[model samples]
Target: MGSGDLNLLKSWNPKLVKNREKVWIKEQELLKENEILKQKQLEITKERELDSLVDPHHKHKNSKKNGLEWMYSDPTHNEDYLLGKKSLDSSVISKNNLKNDSKVDSKIDSEQTKKFDYSNDDPMSKFKIAKKRHIIQTKEKISKPTSPL
Candidate 1:
């Protein structure tokens, strides 16, 4: 259609333009709300991290009813229970735990070169075996395998 015809059509359909404007306004509002929620989440996470640093077992203390319940219950928790776990660590472990232990350890090492501090309540720090294996592998790799006769 001609530019003039298009202009005429637009002039005719003021309601359509208003609807689009309304939709755009709603979308902008939603985006702002989402940003606000994200900021709140970040603040909450930072607070939790601070609390954890001060009291290493803050989560455990609050969640568990008693010492026996905490001990007897399965130490392992599902991904849902472990907040911020997935977000922090991007490395994926192989399905065969026994066979891929070394590989996963290496991956973890390459991903995180710095030694894990026990005081830092890192979600990935739960895998003590992986860190131990990585440390052993790192030492082994450094020393020359050939022995002089």
Candidate 2:
């Protein structure tokens, strides 16, 4: 190649290299920003989960503080128990209440009598009490049963 052509090639090579570096740097910056955004979203999700666990009254406060409008807007997350809707909160409360009441009743029964027959003939009553009794029996079995191994 000629001297002028060689010079031109050398100049163009550095420019091309600089342009490629700039593009790579911009791409890396974009990737970093995307990763940061994803991390922020994950942190927000974790915070919401932790908040839900720690504060059971968060949903109740949302309705009471923000009014029915906000609750209606986000029924899946907020005011889910308003009449016709079947809310997760309601199910959780019912299950917890059933557990607590059964525990209290069993404690009372144990104080009165040594042996308690938990069997009931009524299907609905049996279904309602079965889980609580199963839990109690499992706990007793764990505490009293001798290991074979």
Please report the candidate that would top TM-score against the real structure.
2
Candidate 1: give the clashing pairs.
Answer: none
Backbone clashes counted, model 2 = 0
Over the stretch 1-149, how does candidate 1's per-residue lDDT look in tens digits? 55554543664464577767888899999999999999999998997788689878657644533447655432343354266555322233233344356566776776475455655466576577678889999998888586789
Q: Which ten residues in a row have the lowest lDDT in candidate 1?
A: 87-96
Q: How far is candidate 1 from the true structure (C-alpha RMSD, Å)?
A: 19.4
What is the lDDT, from 0 to 100, of the residue 149 in candidate 1?
A: 100
Every candidate's CA RMSD: 19.4, 17.2
Candidate 2 C-alpha lDDT tens digits along 43-115: 9899879968987877665334334654333124233455557656677878767776777787677657744
Displacement of residue 87 (Cα, Å) in model 2 is 48
lDDT of each: 0.65, 0.70
Candidate 1's clash total is: 0
